[model samples]
Target: MNDKPLSGRKAQAARNDKLILEAAREVFVADPEAPIAEVAKLAGVGISALYRRYPSKEDLLRKLCGDGLARYTELVREALESEGDLWGAFREFLRKVVVADTPSITVRLAGTFTPTSDMFEAAVAADELNRALLARVKDAGVLREDVENGDLALVTESVSSISLGDAERTRELRLRALELYLEALRAPGAGPLPSSAPSEEEMGARWVPKQAK
Candidate 1:
């Protein structure tokens, strides 16, 4: 096998880019407003290399938002298309969206900005598909008839409502909370919920940490 200088450089550049991206995702999930230098440090790359790949923090966030949205939309699509029980599929969607890979970022960006054209389109598609899935569940008498799209949005946003403890414990706390919410959504023997819900301002206030702000 022969490795040309140009090809070698390109391969190294690709590897560095992946490392930077993965590091950025991890750092940002912990603190979205983390400095670019922090990401470079975590990636074990020079700041110059990080900047060469992503010119600025906003640029990196834009890329992450687009990529996250695309992946999330695909998850919903796969769940809907899978040849399995409708209720199980719906629960899986809830579980993944709430607690799966990079969920903190996804939740942070939920119903927020469309950083790019592709992201905008993906957001629209995700919303439409989400509604369709909920409709199917409602029609099948699995989920309650009152479970509107807003209910799902509320549930997602609720992830930000409370902080049980440390970052390491956050996922466990969120999953436990989600399980309670899921049980409440069941069609049969469901109890009444409070007439009022949390406001966007309130949820937004809690979503990001004070340091990140």
Candidate 2:
């Protein structure tokens, strides 16, 4: 009857939860509609255990996206506080986020499941951090006037689309593509980028689960 994690059963439960969540992140992002059994297989955990941890695919999706959002918010906060010139910090932030595939999580999995309250709060926090970081560069006269909040999301997602070959190869290509994007984002180079970024509302609507929307 001991519920302490020091107990073997409790420790196994914790390990199972971690495995299920990790597997869910990979399985769901690659294919959001993939069966729950697939996640269990990937995690090397029993299907019953995955269900015990998540109950439903929707629950799994929410947890995966929430964990991703929390990491993303922390990444943004780190970038904001990083020591460097404004432009340098901004560039490095974009690089690190792309490497983490943070933006790709929300981008790929949007509308797949309803987000929890914590997920919603994390998204807003990340948006605020992004805007604050952008503002710093804009105020310092380094960022282009046309750049907007949603632009970075699209940029990172674009690089994330490169899923050819192995993970190392994909990462190598993403970083290379990111350099091109970073150059475009840097100040005083290109004459006005064509078109406009969608409003955060326009983009954000997709992030809500279809049931909620």
Candidate 3:
């Protein structure tokens, strides 16, 4: 046998898989209902290869959702570490999640399909991390005392849903909604609110509907 080692085809294949996943994320973000064939076309991979990697659309979606959530968790950790402004960091975290290419897939899949393995545990860990971050913000008094844990959960879900809308519109709407939420959370008798508060329409579009009293 030749002394030379096998060519780095394995590394190349790994890189190709990453590229395919990146393309798949774009397709999913743009068209959540798009077929797997469309994802394969966008990823420049054959249908057979796609199926070999992801057995079903739900499987592909689960991978994408997990990847997105992982990134989101990292971003939240980074924001908390880097930004001294507690509320500002929280707002930035929301912005990142909303603008993320994959937002609602995790929630959607969780509600519709049971995870087959321990993967759901990772999701639980993520949620715990999120709660820790929120608790830190609460300790800093950036979030209102009356803001229940459920409120934050709804905020995240709502923001993710809004962000999955038209990109430009989502950006504008998210900012406005953040402003309103922040305003509501501010200390009693705080000075005039920010001049850049979003208009009624923007708030309506981005604001997650409050639960019925």
Candidate 4:
């Protein structure tokens, strides 16, 4: 891998690439169906620049979701190997999830684009890690008995709705919301939940592009 600093046109291209990915995250993460032109406009780069980098809207979406999934799986793998109490590890995992802000990726843009095989594999691996963490917490008797694999996703997904148009403040608000949910999870002798957890199959269906179906 070359570490040499890029100069002139190459340097500017790198900068534009960064802007495009960041703007894409902000734009498509908010509205999966938003046009690619929106990403270019928000990125402050011309449509030609974005097309040169991503070629197509689906290409950009796959890149964004793939990045999100990779980060999430990495965190989950770390949590599995973490020390200290099980509850603490689970709490840390939830906190990291908020910081990663990945629930929105799976919740919002899932079915809008076709996923590659690599993306599907990562999703499966992340799911296995999540179930392991939940199982450990359940056995420790801290988490509510009714909580299920899919329930955890919903708990985190709820925080995705807290957008104050400011990153720092939005994170703070989301953390506060997580605390409330944590308290609810610890409810003593909680009654049975109203429904069963969603299976991976049901969730996977959303990853299939609408046109593919």
Candidate 5:
């Protein structure tokens, strides 16, 4: 019962917890209902270890969701503070969602899980940041005047829906699609867009969709 052996056990446990959490994030991104056994296998840990760290799938889901939201919020904050022009920052934000963070899967899953006020607030804060960014771009006479925060959200959703072969191909095509959409959104000769965008309230209510839920 040497003290060094006990210290090693604690260090190993910490490493196992980190591995399990990382694996769980990747698994949930692929499919939110991916089995804990799969996550354990990916983490190279025993099933018992996953449970020892998480207790239940719900527990693991909550942690993953929280971590995702925090990460997304930070991304938003960074985009806002980016030194580039507002439009570049806005484009980067879209990239971060659809191409960077896997379409905000954590935020998407938050709705499917037991309700949490923290996640809700985080979503709202992110939306507000988007709103401010939209305003800045509009004031600079860059974005089409008709464009609203909801319109930008819709554009991101539309691009996220596109499927193009493998992940690399999908990213390439998505970026091209985004570029086209961004061109359409730019002012100058922008034509009248179709029906008005959904209100922020409507967006919040309908963001995930029944099919996804």
Candidate 6:
């Protein structure tokens, strides 16, 4: 038997695996339908290496989606903790989801694949966190009473899909969706009267547009 320990080789292999996965994720987002050969090339790994790590395209896609959800969940949690206002936290979470190209995989795989596997289960934890955050907001009286957890979840899912346009367009869509949700939660002028609703300038400022040319 060889006297050399395999730790160095194992570490190198792990690093290569990570690089390949990251490259594959970028290709998948840019073109979900791209061929595996193209993905392998983009990853800087040979097709044989790609196959050794991920046996099939479906497997690669699933892994990509799971990774995307995990990252997204972290962003949501951070936003919730950092922003005092419920609506602000929610909006920030939406912005992160829309702006991050990797997170787009979550939107692509939504309602298509079952998330029961270990990887997917971790991803779904993010959804659970969102529910918990929404509950907290409702309890704090920031969000209206009628908005159930399910409703908020649905809104979140929808908002997460606004990646087609620039950040400005996406932010406008988020604000409109959030306004509609708030309106649904309101009890016909029962809550604290607004001294002044969000001004156009405030709304515009809250929405940071993508860097224009």
Q: Model 4 reaches what TM-score against the true structure?
A: 0.88
Candidate 2 lDDT by residue in tens digits, 148-197 = 88888889889988887899998999999999998898787679888889
The lDDT values for all models are 0.73, 0.84, 0.64, 0.86, 0.74, 0.63
lDDT of 3 by residue, 56-135 (tens): 88788667767866787787677667557887787777767766633455444333323434555765666667667767
Winning candidate number (TM-score): 2
lDDT tens per residue, model 4, 1-213: 999989999999999998998999989887887899999999999999899999999899899899899898888888888877877888888899998899988888888888888888888888899888877777778888778788788888898778895889999999999988888887354576676888778767888888888
Per-model root-mean-square deviation over C-alphas: 5.3, 3.1, 8.7, 2.3, 5.0, 11.5
**Best prediction by lDDT:** 4
Off by over 4 Å in 6: 1-15, 80-83, 101-103, 110-116, 148-213
Candidate 1 structure quality by residue, lDDT tens digits, 1-213: 776555888989999988988898888766765678999999999999888888888788777777776777888888778665888888888778766554567665443332556655766788788778888888788898766666776786676455677765877888788888988888863565656545446443543434456
What is the per-residue lDDT of model 6 for residues 1-119, given as tens digits with 9 covering 90 to 100? 89775598787778778878888776766676678888878767789988988898878877777777677778878866865676677656655655564435644544333333676
Q: Estimate each model's TM-score.
A: 0.76, 0.91, 0.68, 0.88, 0.77, 0.59
Clashes of each: 0, 0, 0, 0, 0, 0
Sort order, TM-score high to low:
2, 4, 5, 1, 3, 6
Candidate 2, residue 121: Cα displacement in angstroms equals 2.2
- lDDT per residue as tens, model 5, 1-213: 556544788899999988998898778766776788999999999999889889988688777777766776677777777775877887777777766654545334544456367767877887787777777778878778898877776677677667669879988888889899888888864478789988967767643435566
Task: Name every residue pair that clashes in candidate 2.
Answer: none
Candidate 6 accuracy as lDDT:
0.63
